[model samples]
Target chain A: MNEYKRISPSKRFLINIVLVIIFIVVGTLLTGGDSLSRASRALILQIGIYVILAVSLNIATGYLGQLPLGHAGFMAVGAYSAALFWKATLNMPTPVSIVLGLIIAGLIAAVFGIIIGIPALRLKGDYLAIITLGFGEIIRIAIINLSGITGGTPGLLNVPKYSSFLVVFLCVAATIAAIHFIMHSRHGRAILSIRENEIAADSCGVNLTYYKVLAFAMSAFFAGIAGALYAGFQGSLFPKSFDFMASINILVMVVLGGMGSMLGSVIAATVLTALPLVLQALAAYRMVIYSILLIIVMIFKPSGLLGRYDFSLPGLIEKWMNRKNKPGKEVANE
Target chain B: MVFLQQLINGLQLGSIYALIALGYSMVYGIILLLNFAHGDIIMVGGYIVLLIIAAGISPAVAIAACIIGCIVLACVIEKVAYTPLRSAPRISLLITAIGVSFFLENVAQLLWGADPRVFPATRIIPATSYQIGRLTISLTTIVTLVVAIAAMVVLMLLVQKSKMGKAMRAVSEDMGAAQLMGINLNRIITFTFAVGACLAAIGAILYCCKYPQVKPTTGYILGIKAFVAAVLGGIGSIPGAVLGGIAIGLAEVAVNALGYSTWTDAVVFVILIIVLLVKPTGFMGASMNEKV
Candidate 1:
């Protein structure tokens, strides 16, 4: 039928590669060539970090069907740890130290994730959300009290601004790809099954505890990565940034994007991140608008804009190939 | 002597917390929805009380108006934001509650600028203190303690004795069955919201009396902590909510006395975590098998 539906998988992959190359080229031109304002570049970087957080949250909330309200807590753990690592590794080269900082941040966040996930995942539904919220507050308070390490409420300053547009863009791409890979795997199906029916999944021999904890840990890992990126980009770390409202903002993204959809997360994250900047003229009404939008969206489309729909390049290609393989059947229907 | 004083203060604060926690527990029990907007209703009541007092009304009249305003506001919120989503996913309802909370907070900020306002000084309750040896008990604290206990007793009696309360209990036990038994589900739900808001109004006045200031964001923290109290006491249990509130109040006062005032919020959360871990159903909550 459609001309576009006749494309082969290999050709579709080539087209995607070309499109990505074009996107990178355009980004480089905008950020590096001084055509874009510094504020706009910063906004783009922030969007990149938000995309990572939203996608990670989607994994836990969308795929795993557990609403962990303490995502910001994980991000805080990652950010502070990464910044602390960078501070400690001052003697190392900047790039090497930054890379190491991200890894350590992610690992630390994962550890916290596991710690919280074990106790938290044992809970069902709303109880889990509240407990995670408590855990988030606990993390934030702990950060404030550990003044020696996190620099207390005054915040840790002088973090190197290592998160350039390119770095952030690359990180966002990698995070999305990694998450996509995970969700496309057999384990992902197990996680999704748990979301559909926990009892049914368990009866079918799906390891509920193992999968739930693993999904949570994975969500925390990427959240930490996003936090590390944010710390580097901002060159400052504040306990206030990773508070409950921060978690809510990230949750809003995941919910707005359609829980289990990666592309939806990216689009929602980008739009929401950029919306405030674009609406700077209405600065005071920003949060009012955000809250109102959240309410309206929940009322109008509880399943979100994308619902369970996802944009998969491979799936599209497969459909295209199948269509090509059945030309006569389509003709008969026409 | 100081320990005794702190204990008294804790009781006063705990009484207010218990009132708020009861509101939370009641709504949660009936609807199976955590009414996040319930706290914002207290903020609204405080503002209303402040406005009425600024107009030179009697304190009693101001409190009555505040209670009526809260009751109407809670009923309107349920009818508008919550009613449409009655059959939707529970998470959506929770999100809507959060939305309503945010909307009310922002509206408050817009209406009364975000600055903290001094609650108008009321001469209805004299600012006198009774000194006994090394302890001084303030009039407001005593009033709060008395009002809180009396209110709880009245509420218990109402639930245990009244037809309306019977309807509420039946609805909470099973909405489908209650409807089948010809109960007016909407009226019961609305009545529950009104009663919860009335208690919250009382809590708001007591809170303002002790703190003497009100801000748009004031209710957010108090609401969450009271929610912690509700969960601690066993969410659906009335006595449990009060017990949890007192325990939380005492714990906070003890931490404050220990000079770790900064860790007060963290301590509450820690208690919540411990409770959730040790007793998922809370102190008085019955085990409910989640029906798929």
Candidate 2:
């Protein structure tokens, strides 16, 4: 029997460590060496931020099976909170301030997420979407109106640039790992069960409110970290940057990437973030083309590019070894 | 006198919102989809009016072209983008609608640039005012209210008293049953979109006359607000849309009058959150029980 065997935990850990090392090496090469243009490096960093955003959103839209249109709202909360923190603690060591800023950003965004999620998740489907959207708008308006602190329409300027390639790499890795572990645990299965059938899940004795809010808060938490990275990257923050369109852009990435697939989110985020930059000559047509593509993708493949399939190097290696050992007894596991 | 003037202003604005919200309500009632592109269709109508007027066409012809343009666009979007995904997950359809929305907004931006165009009010509606008692109402506001009310009344009559409307109701009630009953699902859906688009075009024209500007991104916020109205009114209910619209418009005006003009948008959203939290089904919406 040539069935694909699961990789051992220790081997999987080794594979992950190797992959992370490779990522760090590449990141260092891009940031340290002047081989690529500054713009290209910045683009890569932006892709990393979007990867965090997309994967975090997947927790809600994919695993939880609820569409919250105001992801950027949470991102905005994280960004503004982190920016304010960094701005205030500029006198501290850069690394210390940056770490604290990210934590504060994540925690504050999680708080807002709980606050929004509790009331918002009481409804389902489109009603939930509209409510979250309203909350998003409210947050943005609050930021604008509280200009004394948020800098109003002029935006918060001159933030410390602490989002180097290393920082972003570490954050992206942590986010993916955290999400991967949570999604693999019993809690993840419960979240998935809700997505599949909320009523069935509730009948199975899953605490619907607790898990829904939990997934939402976790999603908001990572989005907050990404926002903190973004604030540090841009060295400024604006309420307008976290508007509805920005949320939609991130959603598009998650949707295009197969929902519930971290690998898909990473790849889609990378490609989409770089596409506009690469096609600078067709900049005017970029969004139009992107939208058309989105429509086409939805129409043809509603499950998205990956359809919940995740990539695993160890799994691939195991399958290859199995194929070599048994030529005629091949069996598909998935 | 100030309160009276503000009331008139609120009514005018609310009527425009009600008109737009009707389009949202009608389309959403028939299809469980949000049609996020609905607002962009109104933006397209605004561009059509601007272009036709710029081409030196008569104002009446320009307005006609605008309405037709919007109807055609909405119908085409339904056919091209949404028809195939009728059986897909609701989220997919919603995302596709967002795609269409971005597509329209980007196309408008590409064709017309990102700058706002000054809609010539005098060229269409006469720039006259009526001094009634202590309230001075502009002719534009009167025309907007009259046209909005007239369109809404006709829409209500059509939906309530017509055979096609019955077909639409049947389809919305149960698509599979409606098909079994020999209703042409595609035709009814397309017709609903057309009717909704026509109203949106009318609302767009009135909105332009009232605001005196048109831009690509204008529809995004306007659409969200109208969607809020639709939600606040009971999404599938027609009269609920109007009541929700008027409530939002009045609340906005009241905030502005309270010298918190900058917080108008915030106030509108606050009302929406409160309404949704307190009444998820909205004011006039019938609660839909989920079947296992």
Which candidate wins on DockQ?
2
The weakest ten consecutive residues by lDDT in model 2 chain B span: B283-292
In terms of lDDT, the poorest run of 10 residues in model 1 chain B is B283-292
What TM-score, computed on C-alpha atoms, does each candidate reach?
0.95, 0.96
Highest TM-score, which number?
A: 2
For model 1, the stretches where C-alpha displacement exceeds 4 angstroms are A1-18, A314-334, B121-124, B287-292
DockQ of predictions, in order shown = 0.66, 0.76
Worst 10 residues of 1 chain A by lDDT: A1-10
lDDT of 1 by residue, A274-323 (tens): 99888888878866877887788888998778887888666676786676
lDDT measured at residue B4 in model 2 versus the true structure, 0 to 100:
84
Candidate 2 residue runs with Cα over 4 Å from true position: A1-6, A330-334, B287-292
